[model samples]
Target: MYERVEEMIQGYIWKDLGVKVIEAVDGEVTLHMPVKTRQTQFHGNVHGGVLATLADMSMAAAVNTLVEEKEFTVTAEIKVNYLRPAAGDFLEAKGKVIKRGRTLSHCQAEVFDDSGKQVCFVVATFYMFKKE
Candidate 1:
C-alpha cells in the first residue's frame, strides 16, 4: 500500500515539485529532491519556498497513505521553520503524522541537506474531505 501511494505521487505530482519518495511506512514518508541551479535564491542558497513545498508534499503523501480511499486531503495550514542555509547536492524530507482526526490530520516534516544536517522543519494540518 505504501509503495502504491509512493508511486502514485512520484508518477503524478512530485515531478512538478522536484521530489521523489525514497521510503514510506505506516506513519512516515521519506523523500528526496535535488538542489539545482534553478532552485537557488539570489543569495545562491536553496530557496525557502522549495523547502516548504517539499515538506508539504511529503506530509500530504504521508496523510494520503493513511486516509480512506474515498477521501482526499488538502493542506489547511502549514508552518515552515528554516533552521539553516541549504546548499549542496540534494535535500531530504521526512514526514510523519502527529495526529489524525475524522475531518483533519496533522503532520510534521523535516528537511535535511546532503550532509545529513537539518535545514528546515514543518508542521501542517490537512482537511480530509470525503469523495463524492
Candidate 2:
C-alpha cells in the first residue's frame, strides 16, 4: 500500500518538495519535509498551499492503506487550519483515516514543526477510483 501511494506521489507533482517517508501502516502514515528546499511565500513563511499538499498526500497514503490493490484516491475536499507560523529545521505530517466508504474517505493530518508543535491541522475527504 505504501509503495502504491508512494508511486502516486512521484513524478512532477511534488517532485521538488523532497518529501521523505517516515513510516506507513494500515490507516496511518507519516511524512517528513526538510527546510533546505522548502518553498516559502514572499513573507518568508511556509507556503500554505504546500502545507495543504502535504496534508492531502498524507491523507491519500493513509487511505490507500485500507483500500483494495486497484483502488486509488484523490482529494475531493479539504479544510486546513493554519494554527501557527511554520518555522524550523524540518516539518512532519502525520495522517490518519478516520472513516471509509465505498466512494469517499474521511481523513485528518496534522503538520508539526521540528519541536513537534502543530502548525497546521487538516480534515479532508478523498474520492476513490478503481482501475478498469
TM-score of each: 0.91, 0.91
lDDT of each: 0.87, 0.85
Model 2: per-residue Cα lDDT at residue 30: 94
What are the per-residue Cα lDDT tens digits for candidate 2 across 27-132? 9999898865347877787888888888887888889888787887889999999998887788899999999989999999999989999999999999988986
User: Per-residue alpha-carbon lDDT of model 1 for 1-132, expressed as tens digits?
Assistant: 564475567554477656877988876889898888988999999999989988988898888888766777889999999999999989999999999889989999999999999999899999988887
Q: Which ranges in model 1 have alpha carbons more than 4 Å from their true place?
A: 1-13
Candidate 2: which stretches are off by over 4 Å?
none
In candidate 1, which residue pairs clash? Answer: none
What value of lDDT does candidate 2 attain over all alpha carbons?
Answer: 0.85
